[model samples]
Target: MTLLQAFVTLPVLLPMLGAAASVIVSPRASLQRVIGVVTLALVCVVAGVLLVSADSYGPVVAQLGGWPAPMGIVLVADRMSALLLLISTLVTLAVLVYAIDQRISDYGRETASTTFHPIFLLLSTGVSLAYLTGDLFTLFVAFEIMLASSYVLITRRTSASRIRSGMTYVIVSLMSSLLFLTAVGMVYAATGSVNLADLAGRVGMLPEGLKTVLALLLVVVFGIKAAIVPLHFWLPDSYPNAPAPVTALFAGLLTKVGIYALLRTQTLVFPQDHPSTLLLVIAAVTMVVGALGAVAQDDLNRLLSFLLVSHIGFMLFGLAVYTPSGIAGTALYIVHHITVQATLFLVSGLITRRTGTVSIAQMGGLAQTAPHLAVLFAIPAITLAGLPPTSGFVAKLALLRAGAGATPAAEIVAAFVVLASLLTLYAVARVWVRVFWGTPKEPLVDNDPNDELVVGTARSARGMYVGASSLIVVSIVIALFAGPLSAIASRAGDDLQTREAYRSAVLGPDTAPGGPGPVPVAAVPQGPAAAGGGAAIGAMTADDAEGTTSR
Candidate 1:
């Protein structure tokens, strides 16, 4: 095996090992933080190396213990996997810092300080492995790793409210896991193997009805994980109940994992299917539903949670189209959304820290008192709103441009996307007006006309803003480098569409899984953005909460 091939496993391997090390030193919080940060930082470095190797020499594939494909566990890294690896690692690191601060500063709440590092590291291990694994069951294992750790993290806060929400999350996640396992069983029973390369060929050859059935089963499972409409009810409740750091982590990475699986399976298993049409309908509904839900929420975290579901629809739009532009756009959007979403949540934590609540009506003129926080909030607020020159705008423009030339169905989906974008702006704008702008006004009516309002003493933690602002800077960096990033995304999209190189890379050029010849290496494509083809897309950030009590 080549050196690069060997390097492909480090992202998962290093983190797993580091988690063990962190556990050994778990009694020491400072040491644990150092270990966690160093370990994940190294993981990021390895991921960058793998990304460079993949970009230079097609998809990198490494078989575990020299076991061959379809039998041995395999690791594969291409532009997409590598890109996501970097994103996930960086986000986890930032959130780790934020979480550490929360544990230290918010001692009023229960914080599992000792177990946090190990569990968080394990969570990173799962996310890394999920991106790298080339076999279906291995992906399943990866999911469990993440889910198990997530269960602990979400339930770390011992309040009755959090426990109730955690139970809901656990039940829903268990159900999705069952669905995923069942779908895999069916796929294995039909295809005779579970390796992605093996299934790639087998999936295409299945009878039309079976193919559609299999695809939809997989879609439903991922749909739940991704929080698609009708399946997203758990998010608004479960997410907001977690501590702010956990909320940020779950919001940024968890649903995206579901989306990542969908992307992988969509290209490898059903490359030629017209499922995008169905996805378009779901996308339209998801967008409207999520945005409207966001509009109706008074809890800041819950409002963000609904918006999370809505934006997933945007990514769905790109994936549904099955074109180079569509996939690239989706990829870019995922990255943008992750950073901006995390930034907003981090800002949410900062706001709550100062005001003791996320209720907009209880908040009074944060802009005047905390100008630095206001500035931090404003950057991402505008970025998330799809304002000009921000990465969000660029990503949306790419999706719209791609859809503009697609089928009539795609055109209709595009209209819904535009409507959702405007509505998203309004939702964030409302937050700006209610939370950051005017006075903190009390309600005119109350429960039994006797409700009481509690105002918290505003306080600032030393390192909290540091961690939060880092993510805002990340979002800004993404916007600034939209061109190169889009080109890379375009290349990944092309590679996904041209599945030959991937299977051959993993299964070997000589014994390409489904073919009789050597796998041909493919070149990365330069995106339309390289030529400045579309209108400049910019972004803004927003989130808000308002109370419904009496004065």
Candidate 2:
């Protein structure tokens, strides 16, 4: 393997190694924290290098076990995947710091030992693997890794309510995993290959009915993960029950990973020539439903969770358009949302620290005493609402431009986009009025000792602030660099549309789809071939053999 190819694996390998090391060093709280932080920091740096390499030199392909694509595990760091990886690693690093500080403040340095660091690193590894994997089966494994780690994180130091909510989360996640596995099986059964580059060439050749079923099945599976609309019921309950930092990490990374998978698979395996009417309608409904849900929520985390679900529709809006501009817009929105959503959740953590309650009704006059906190909340809130001069506005504007097409579906969904933004602004404004603008109120003290409501020591609070502010700065930097980022996103969109660049990167120029010899078509049954018979099976097998021999 070349140097660049080897570097791609570090993001995954380093974290797995670090997780094991963290396990061995368990109960050494300081060392575990350093290992987790340093591991993520290294990943962040590696991801940055990958983004640069991919943007400048095309995709970085690493075929593991010295095997080739369509046969062995492959990791491809394309422009899109590399960009998302960098952002994810940075967010994970920030959330880890915040968690460490929170732990120290709530339960001293010695008590901050055991399962947390290892599991968190494992989750980071899963996230990196998910983005970099070049096939479906590996992606499933990555999801399982993340789910296992997240389950432990959510239920770790919890009350009865959190445990119950964790159960809901686990159950829902397991169901989606089963569906995802089934989809992978169906795709492999039909195409004889699960590698994305291989599937790119073969899936289109399947019977239209069978292809459509597989596509929709994959969509539903990812939709459950991404928390879009009707599938989003588990999120608000599940996320709000977790500790602040864990909620922030999940809010930012998990759903975006789901959306990334949707983008990668839909564009590669089930290429759409025109805007999907079904997706557009779904986007519209999700935006409205999630926004309305947010407006109705009394709890701060629950409201933010609803807004997270609502904004996912915006990203879906871009995918629904199925054009280069639309995809670019989606890419930009994903970057913006990942930063803004995580920042909002982190800021929510700070708010809870001060107010000692999740209810907006119980919070008041924070703008008077904690002006800095107000500033932190305002920036992300304005961004989340798609207001002027922010990353959210830039991303939303791109989507709007993409949506101004001749199609009626685009126009209708565009309207819903605007409606959702307005609702988001109103919801945040309500929080501002209730939580910041009113007369000062004492912190609400709950009887539950396990309730995640504590104002930490000044030093620890400073650590938490630093963590949250770092991401806030990141969101600002995204806004500042919107022009270049948008350009990069446009290029990424073009790459996805073309498909050949990715195929060549992973499968080698000689073996890439449409290169050398006839493209291998899967021996899937159709029409009379569907009937069970030795002759038909033998005929299909013979055809496949001929195709393989020709290659």
Candidate 3:
């Protein structure tokens, strides 16, 4: 294997190795902190290198253990994977620094510093692995790795509430994982292969009935992970209770992974001749429902969680449009959302740390006391509401343009998207009014008297604020550099529309050089008719819908 390939794989491997090494070498709190910071720094460096290499050399694929594609495990880094990896690494590194700062105050420095480092590194490893894996089975394994590590991180302090929330998170994640496993098993039984490239090649040949079933199953599994409307109940329940740093990472990275899986599997593996109107309808409802839930929430974390769900539907709208513009918009939205969401969560954590509560009703006039915190929160809040001069604006514009050009139903989808953004604006504004604009309801409290030396010291909360600001700055950077980023996104969308690029990159160039293979003939049930009363089954063509093609 080439040195570049080895470098690409180390981002995933280093964290897992670090997790174990941290546990074995020394349980010293200071040592663990050093190890965690160093390990994540290395990861970020590797991720940066990979992104640069991908930009110049195209996607990098490494056969695990030197086994070739289609028969052995493979890790591939395309534009999409590379971009997401960079975002994830930045979020992890920021959170790690914040965690180090808050270790003693939140959980005793000894326990918080040691336990968190190992689990968090493991979680980072799993997230990286999930993004890079080329095979469906490896994706599942990565999902488990992430879920397991997160389970520990969520319940790190083991409080009653933390344990309860962690249990809910664990149960919901495990059930989704099981459903995903079942779907994988069924797909393997039907197609005789679990490789994503191979599955993409064979999906069109499967009977319409089985194809519909597999697609529906996948939607359920990914929906659970993405926190889509009805399936999103667990997020508000669990996210607010974890450590602030853990919550930041969860808000920023985990749900996006689900969205990534949905986009990857739906568009890449199961290319359909016609777009699924069902997904379009669900996207609309998800946007409206999630926003309404956010409006009802008074807790800072719960509000952000609901908004996360609502924003996901915006991305879904782009995916539903099944156009290059829509896909590109979704890609941009993913980047925008990750940065904005992480910033908000970290800010919320700061609020909780200072005021000793996340309840909006119990906190007020934070802007006066902590002007920096207020500014940090404001940036993400405005961005989340899709205000101008932000990446969020660019993302929404792409979706609106796509929706305007789509069918009549797409017009309604566009309307819902707009309304959802407005509602998000209202919700965030309400939090602003309640938490920052009013008279101070209570003074800041230092709960740990023994830690007086660090209490209100520059090192403790400053690190948290710095982490939050760093992410907000990234959102601004994305907005400023929208031209180049949009160009890359457009190329990604174009590549997706023509699956040959992806297929040839994953499978060999000789395996269907120009387009996907012929459609398969396996039999399964079909979904209900389209929303406009059109028949679900109709004439098929290679380029009839986004990503659909005859093998």
Candidate 4:
């Protein structure tokens, strides 16, 4: 493999290796923390290099262990994967730093040694693998890796509530994985390949009814992960109960992976003349339902969890359009949301640390006592609400433009998007008003020695602030660089639509240009082919053989 290819792969490998090393070495607490930070820092560097290299060299692909495309595992980094890798790495790094400090504060030096470092690194590895894998089956494996690691992290404290939440999370996740596997099996049965590029080529040839069934299955599988509407009951229950940093990471990265997979599959594997209209309706409902849930929540973490679900619908709206602008909007939204959401979660955790609770009713006057924290929270809150001069605004604008220019049905979808944003703003402002502006509802508690901990101390708040602020700064940077980023997203969307570029990039230029080769007009069955041996089966097998020969 070349140097660029190595850079592309290292982000995933570094975390996996570091997790194993952390377990075996049994390092000192400080050393374990160092291992986690340094390993993630290295991943950040590698992701950055891959981003630059991919921009200059175009998409990079590596066939694992010297095997060829159709037979071998491939790790491919296109503009989309590279962009997600960069964002996810940054979020994981920030969360890792915050977790390190939070552990020290909450558990002190003794028990901090147990599982945080190892599990977190493993989680990073799983996320990285999900973004890098080039095919469907491997993506499923990556999803499982992430799900298993998350289960351990979520239930680490072993409280009754935590255990309950963890069980729900595991059950939901396992069912989704099984659904995904079944979808993959169906696709493979129809197409004879699990490689995404190959599937893209063959998907258009499948019968309409079968395609619709496969598409619906995929939507359910990924929707469960993305926390879309009816499938999102697990999110509010699971996320708020996990440790703060774990919640932050989950908020920032996990659902976005689902979004990524949804976008990839819909755009690449099933690009038909008229895509699923039902997805548009789902998008609208997801946005409205999620925002309404957010509005009703009084607990800070639960509120944000609902907001996360709501914003996921916006991304879905962009993807549901299946146009270049829609896809670009979705990409920009993904990048912006990761940083902004992680920062908000971190800041919320900081509030909980200071006030001893996340219930907004129990907290007040934080701006007076924790001015910096209030400002930190405000930055992301405003951005999340789609305020101007932020990446969030850019993303929302892109979606609005796409929606306005889309089919007449999209105009209604656009109205829902606007309504959702307005509701989101109100929801976030309610949190702001309750937490930062209202009169102190509960007296400052200094009786317990632990409660007497000073606010704004370098030791207590610095690490958390640094982590949150770093992501906040990144969100601003994305806003400033919006033009270039949007261009990259547009190109990525274009590549996804005309997947010949991706197929050639991965499978080599030898394959026929428009896609393997078109099925002969006479070969395509007008209706269902016969189930048992007959002329229809013979024709189907002959068609498959001919297509393979052309390749």
Candidate 5:
């Protein structure tokens, strides 16, 4: 591998390797934390490098073992993918710090010592790989990696509630996975390829009947993951039951992966003439339904969970429009939401920790008890509501402005988007008034139900404070630097909308536009390449070949 290829692979390679190493050091809490932090920090730096490189030099790809295209596992880093990678690692690192310092890990216990760090690192690896991979099956593998880790993480404390929710989460995820795998089968059965660039080259030639079926199939699968409206019922139930930091991590990473997948497949694999119409309907309904759900929630965690689902509609609205300005706005909104949502949840964690309850009905006067926490909560709450002087406002303006050009449909979705923002403001404002502004409602006594979860409140650590605050600072920075970030997002949007650069980058220069045809998958490994690579073309995957079965 060339030196640059090494850099391209580092973000994936380092974290999985670190996760493996973490197991050996699991007996030592300090050492395990060090491994997890350093691994993510390095991945962050690598992701930053890839983001700059992709923005400056165009997309970069590495084919393992120096093999070619669909024949080898390829990792491609484009501006969009790298941008996602950077923010994911940042959130992962921040959430990890919070978990560690909150003493939530219970390090000396075997389960805590053995499971948390390894799964945590593995989860980060999954997010990075999901963003970076070039093929559908590889993306599926990455999703499974994420799912396995998440299953363990969500059920960590083994409460009945946790197990029940985890079961729900798993069933939903498995259904998505099964749909995704089925879609992959359809894609390969139809086009003889699962590599995204190859699929992009060939999908345009497919019968509209097949294309529409494939498009809807992929949308439903990803919709389930992104928590878009009707499919979002599982999220509010599942997220709040996990540990605070774990929930924050889920808020930050998981659903966004689904959104990212939707964005990728929409632009690359399923950009048929009429798909946007359905997307618009989904976006509008998701915004209205999610915001309505948030309006009645008294629990802060569940409330944020609903808002999380609601705001995905904004990104979908941008995608539904499917224009450059629309996508750039979506991209910016995504970066904004990831940080802001995670920060809000982390702040929620702090609120639950400091105030002895997440329910505002019984919670009051937290500002008097933890003034700094009040300010911390206030920044993200206002920002999430799309109030002025924050990145959320910038994101909302960009989406609305983009919507203006898309006419009556975009305009309708835009209205829902605005309504959702107002509802979000009201919901968050209620929490502020009831919890932080009023006098104590019940005196936070030892026997209080809220106090049951507030162990070690007086001794709260700096890591929890600093981790949540750092992301808030990031949200502010994005707001302040909206102009430059918009440029990057615009460039990324251009790349996604224009498939030529990605094709050429992943499949070599001959795969550029105006090609006779996509460089055939068989041709990828024909010269001085593995014979089995060519033989594998248009075949069922190994898991399929081995007869995958539920039981």
Candidate 6:
């Protein structure tokens, strides 16, 4: 295999290997920390190289087990997946560092537990698989891996309240999984294959109603995971109760992974010539509702969780526009949100360490006492609010420009974007004035000593600050280098919308969608009717059935 192909698998494989090694070296906290850090750093490097290669050479394809796509496991890294993977690895690395320090600070150096590092690495593995996998079934498997690891992380060292919240997260996640699996079965039944490039060709031949139903089904499945508006109820309760670093990781990567799935599948299998009106409406409602929810929240983490839900609308809005510029805007927004949201959550953890409370009303005089922490919080806070010269502003501007065309639907959603940003500014400014500007308040009494997030001392916060600050610097750099980054995002967006390059990369050029080449006899159904709705209604011949694999 070529070096680029090798780079494609390393991002996923390295984390899985790291997780296993961490488990074997369990109970040795320091060594495990080194392994986790080094593994993630290497993955980040690989991801960066993959991004450059993909941009220069089109998608990088790696067929595992020496089998071709639609028959065996396939991993494809295009500009979109490569960029998201790179950002995810970097954010997870920073969060892991903050988590390591928090563990040592709350417990001790030798007392830090073993499960955290392994489980965290597993979470990163799942995310890598979700982004890199070239088939729908593999995506389902990736989501399951992520859900399993998250279940353990959410409930680890839990109190009754956390257990209750974790249960809500689990039940909702399982329901989504079942729905996702059902959708996969439906797609396989309809298209005779679940390989994304294969389906990209075949799904277009199905009846319009069936295709629409499948598209909506996948949207609902991913929407629940992305925490978009009406589907986001479980998130506010579930995320805030976890230890801060875990919350940061989830906020930064989990929902965005869901958005990535939406961007990937909708553009490939369910390509639309016009912007989707239904998606646009959902995006507007999500933006308005999430911003309003944040305004009412008193707890710092819960408020940030609400804002996380709110910004998901921006990504959705970009997708709903269904233009290359819209998709590019979404790409930029995801990168910005991943870094800024994670930084905000980590800084919230630092504030909890210093003040012993997450309640915005209860925190006071941080600007005067913990001035460094206040500065740390302010930068991300303003970025999250989409103020000028930050990554958020650049991303939002892209979305606005994309939606600035003649369509009323795009115009309406663009207005909602502005309203949401204004509300977000108000909500975060309230946090700033309430938490950082008032007379100093004493630390809240440790009502729940079992909750490590609010019970930790600030003595060992230097590493935590470093972790959070690294991302803060990343967010700022995104602003400073917005031109090149925006160019990359635009190219990635064009690649996603075009679909030809991706299909060519995954299923060789001979079998790429729309290519002037012979179709795989097993891929196309027998008759004209069979080629259309025939497959959906059991039109596959015995020989064809024997030829196709479950993947």
lDDT of the candidates, in the order given: 0.79, 0.87, 0.80, 0.82, 0.82, 0.89
TM-score between model 5 and native = 0.91
Question: Lowest-scoring 10 consecutive residues by lDDT in candidate 6?
Answer: 542-551
Please give, for residues 1-551, the per-residue lDDT of candidate 6 as tens digits: 47778788998899999999999988788889999999999999999999999889899999987798877889999999999999999999999989988888778789746678889999999999999999999999999999899999999997888899999999999999999999998887766678888788776656666778999999999999999888999999999999899999999999999999999999988998789999999999999999999999999999999999999999999999999999999999999999999999999888887788888888899899899998999999999989998999999999999998728989989999999999999999999999999898887666777666555355645789899999999999999999999999999999888888998888888766553223544545543244355454435442333344222
lDDT digits (tens) for residues 1-551 of candidate 2:
38889999999999999999999999688999999999999999989999999999999999998899877899999999999999888888988888888888887878755688999999999999999999999999999999899999899877788889999999999999999999997777666667898788776666666778999999999999999887999999899888889999999999999999999999988998899999999899999999999999999999999999999999999999999889999999999998889988988988887777888998899899789989989999999999988999999999999999738879989999999999999999999999999898887654565555454212335778888999888888999999999999999999997788899888789866563222544343431244333445434543554555566
lDDT of 2: 0.87
Model 6: per-residue Cα lDDT at residue 471: 98
**Candidate 1 on 313-412: residue-level lDDT in tens?**
9998889988878888888888888888888888887776666676766766778777898898888878877888887898788889878878899999
> Largest TM-score belongs to which candidate?
6
The top-ranked prediction according to lDDT is 6
TM-score of 3: 0.90
1 versus 4: better lDDT goes to: 4
Off by over 4 Å in 5: 104-112, 272-275, 442-456, 515-551
3 or 6, which is superior by lDDT? 6
**How many collisions per candidate?**
24, 0, 14, 0, 0, 0
Candidate 6 local accuracy as lDDT? 0.89
- After superposition, candidate 3 runs with Cα above 4 Å error: 104-114, 444-460, 513-515, 518-551
Model 2: weakest 10-residue lDDT segment is 522-531
C-alpha TM-scores of all predictions: 0.89, 0.94, 0.90, 0.91, 0.91, 0.95
Poorly placed runs, candidate 2 (over 4 Å): 451-460, 514-518, 522-551
Quote the positional error of residue 225 for candidate 2 in Å: 0.2
Q: For residues 270-310, what per-residue lDDT tens digits would candidate 3 score against the true structure?
A: 76545468888989999999999999998888999999999
